[model samples]
Target chain A: MLRALRVASPLAVVALWQLASSLGVLDPSTLASPAQLARTAWELTRSGELPHAVAVSARRAALGFALGAAVAIAAGTVVGLSRVGDAVLDPLMQMLRMLPLFGLVPLFIIWFGIQEEPKIYLVALAVVVPLYLNLVAALRGVDRDLVEVARVLRLRRAEAVRHVYLPAVLPGVLVGLRQALGLAWITLIVAEQVNAGAGLGFLVNNARDFLLTDVIVVGLLCYAALGLVTDGVVRALEWRALRWRDGGETA
Target chain B: MTGTDLTTPVVAAAHGVRRAFGDHVVLDGVDLEIRRGEFVTLLGRSGSGKSTLLRIVGGLDQGAEGDVRTGTAPAVVFQDPRLLPWRRVLDNVALGLRGPDARARSTEVLDEVGLAGRERAWPRQLSGGQRQRVALARALVREPDLLLLDEPFSALDALTRISAQQLVRRLVDVHRPAVLMVTHDVEEALLLVDRVVLVDDGRIALDEEVGVRRPRRRDDPDLVRWRTRLLGLLGVADA
Candidate 1:
């Protein structure tokens, strides 16, 4: 069955890898054995190095994401609602969206210096465009008839947004959040690992200099864990927001 | 039906209304009015500008060159229910109106529409007929002096349409909001409205009052005769 193979294949690969390490076919310094990586991870956890690095990375990602998402949502709402706002902000966003954001790492380093500022700004820049684009597209796709219904009811400006536009654009906003969060992690990795700083990426950089293969693998695993956790949080928010799609009153 | 006459206050009126999409005209210098407590239906073929004129009178169309006046914003029940899928029945019904009693009034309207226990239900959970009922409830909750129903029941099944029609008839009688419904169904036009106007060539081809009383059967002699006349006016030769 596919279910069993899905579980067994990864285990088989790990077993083969450990066997190769024991037989000395693989260099322990170049690529750590599964047992060795696990041992180093345990040691780092006890010594508090891994935990401290994770905390620092989490703080940077959270701050950058919060800043980016807030500004993007506000800009998107303005452009989507008013024609005047659309005229000014929409063209600017269209041009900005095409910027190869990851390629700005060097420029960011120059402007913000090789510190938390560069890393955080890199993450922030990477996230803003996609969320803004998705929110604007969602607003454009709202049903014309629904808009007419609002006009017929003569809803006030604020009331129309609350009753019509907010819920209409929510699914798109949530989708954009997931995408932006993934890109945030990838950008953080690039920014931190390439430059001087403290974080998971710094840990990876330090391990490479010392040739500690086990520590490097542990740092990579930490990145994967943080990414999954952030994505899971967004998914939970999505379920709560769109409960009207399937779940009933009792549910 | 409630003694509508020339002296009754007009809830909505449009004079010399003209609208065109580039070279093609949809409504051509049409004039119409709905008196207080009266139900009027515009019967027309597809693309005959019936819906366009309704939209113009309801303030949804601004391209028309005309003098249009109406009381407070008309409550509209569009062909598609147009319920907010994310909003619960209660929230949807309470959409425009404000104040603390909004929810309580919305609940009362929902109950009147036979959706008494569905306040917390999402629009997606309801059947087509139930959703239309919620749309009606939403319109009625506003307590507008003018009500617009744009083919509101046309999308329902035959049996469901009959019940929906009856519900509209019942509500109009109770609330007495000046009503204008657009429908191609001749029988529906005759069965529901105090006056029936036939639209042809982007203009009102025929407008007449129905003398038939309420609680009348579909097979009643007067409605049958009116149905034949209206269908003929709508360009159906053999009815």
Candidate 2:
């Protein structure tokens, strides 16, 4: 019964929404009924237009997220481990993280032009700060007793990292990945709206010009679905990697 | 050289070891020597620099001014069982070991430490005594010439502490490493060690040999006398 209620909750919301639209509590031109949104989504899917836009957006998000995560890990490792790296890089990073990331979109467009490069760069820039900050904090927070044990065990530099530091920092890194994924999607949406020639944001904007509210709703739902799917993936990774933690829910 | 007592090899030795932290001095011209198969306990108050000396001998810190020489790399067990939580019990024991035989060696040591068939258990799943047993297994797996223990059993409850102490005594008899344990517990020092070196004000204040026979009772007259004497040195009013 509880499981059925879980499924029914969303259905009930949609049913009420549909009823409200039919009763003219919501204007059809401004807010489409769930039925109209479903029909538009089905038509877009059948015509392959929705899928194509999704593919483009997913490609951009994947490329940008990967690049951002890789650099953050590398930089965070260096800064967290070495005194010189912290002295040279940490203040600069802290300063840069202070500027609102959304405000950088215009600067990125001016620097990289209004091509796909700017969109991808915007997502990377937005995602990098959270990942780097989280990873650095985690690395610094590794148990001092464990590190001392590694030393007493006579673990060399590389062995200490493998046996001690990496595992200690991994849960935090996964948390950073979740935060960065959310930020990446938000940045991608704004970037696409500001300058993209194609993608889901493009679909939403195109529908808005024609005042097709149902199509707009479908595009927004796709974005929401994508966010949930990516978050689930990160959560699954956290579960497997941090299995030793009690209750197994580090994320 | 002391001609009368040079038969057993000195496994670990410190010559005039001195350490100071800025204005405060922790260890002042402390010297120690441990022979092969000897169990020595450095008994002291909380700030007596016993742990500092252990760290220097363990090669974890070398900021002090002194000569510290060991026959082989020493193994240490800290107050807390510092097992890597991500690794299983077997892997934590095998942490210092390398090569393909690490697993087999770890398995053998776990069995010897009475934790057989618990290889897959995480550190958090084990009881406090069990975790310390894992730590002892880790140190013993190295077959260290000198085992430096820094109050390794202080965290356990009284009964668990006794059992863990018995485990250490049994393992010491079997492994025969030159052990240097630092602790404030006078009874613990008397029960486990062959020699008790009272450390105070950064120096060895007393070095007494325990001549009590094996499997001796806690109420034994000689053991009680030594315990009272050691507790007095620890500044306790009564035994």
Number of the predicted model whose DockQ against the real structure is largest:
1
Superposed model 2: Cα runs more than 4 Å off: A22-25, A247-251, B1-5
Docking class of 2: medium
Tens digit per residue, CA lDDT, model 1, A149-173: 8887778988888888888888998
lDDT of 2 at A46: 99
Model 2 lDDT tens row, B1-239 = 11214588899898999999998899988888898888899889999988888888777777888898865868988898989999989989988688889999999999998999989898888889999999999999999999999998899999999999999989988888889999978888877888888889888899877888778688889999998888888889763
Please report, in order, the local distance difference test score of every candidate based on alpha carbons. Answer: 0.88, 0.88
Clash pairs for candidate 2: none
Instruction: State the DockQ of every prediction.
Output: 0.60, 0.52
Error of 2 at A145 (Å): 0.8
For model 1, what is the alpha-carbon lDDT of residue B121? Answer: 86
The global Cα lDDT (0 to 1) of model 1 is: 0.88
lDDT of 1 by residue, B13-48 (tens): 999989999999998879998988999998889999
The best candidate in terms of TM-score: 2
